[model samples]
Target: MPRLGLNPDHLALAGAELADESGFEAVTISRVARRVGVQPASLYSHVDGSADLRDRVAMLVLGEMADAATSAIAGRSGRDALGAFADSYRDYAHRHPGRYEASHRRTSPSPRTVDEGRRHSTLSAALLRGYAVPEPEHVHAIRLLGSTIHGFVTLEFTGGFAHSAPAAEVSWDRIVDALDHLLRTWPTSSTDV
Candidate 1:
């Protein structure tokens, strides 16, 4: 019999907190059950297992990040919008490194849809629309933006940019400007000369 007031959402939410406190790798059913003051077996009723719980946590984090990014970039457009989006993403990644990692995890959407990724893509597409970017160029532009943001952030998180200069802020601004310029004049098929 399931415990009264215990549920999947409660367990998943608690697991998310555990992830924040101990890192995603440390999150486990046993640990979560202990944190929740429930027997480890009790958790099985709410979650199928570790993978299901982890996926739920990932989805929650992704949704939160999407919401934050969406709110941050609202009422903005063009480079301003892009800057807001990029800055917001970096901020979220820095603040919630574990959740940020989960947000970008490549997984086939089954019970957990990556709607947050879709929302983010919408924002990126909107930015591309402002640039008049066409077909493959637009897709490439979006990937470029995503890669630039993720690459910088991931490297910084892992101390890969330890000895660099110009500061993250300066580099970030320059990157945004570079992206803006790239989007504004996305190289078409005939531009390879």
Candidate 2:
């Protein structure tokens, strides 16, 4: 017998909320059951277990990130698009720190997750089109961009900049500008030189 008004999606949503309230590691079937006023066994019908629940949270986070990235880069190009794309990631991390952390977890691939992952890649490639990065170098460029954004956001999110002199915002703008210039002038292969 399933509980009324409770399903996989609802449970997943509750898990995500719990992840945000505490860390992702804090999300457990027992805790979520308490959250929804049910016993731990009651959630078994909705989620396979803790792993399945975490996978659902990962999928939800990825989907939300893809949607935000898509919206952030729409009708924009060049540095404007680049900044917005980068900011979208930072904003999402700040807004949903736990869900953002869950996004880094490896999960079993399902159709929805695969599609969301592809959409993120497609959006990145599309954003890169505004710069002069050759197709061959796009993978490298994407890695650089993703690393830079992730590194900066992680540090900022974890109070790494608390003791800094200049504001993190100032550094962020400079970093984005530097990325823009670097992408615009992406170097050619050594053989071409």
Clashing residue pairs in all predictions, respectively, total 0, 0
> Candidate 2's residue-wise lDDT over 3-78, tens digit each?
9999999988898999999989988999999999999999999899999999998888888998999999999999
For 60-125, candidate 1 gives per-residue lDDT tens digits of: 887787788778777887788888889988999888877777766565577456565677787778
Name the top lDDT candidate. Answer: 2
| Candidate 2: residue 17 Cα off by (Å) | 1.0
Q: Which candidate is the best by TM-score?
A: 2
lDDT score for residue 13 of model 2: 89
Off by over 4 Å in 2: 190-193
* TM-score, cand. 2 vs. native: 0.93
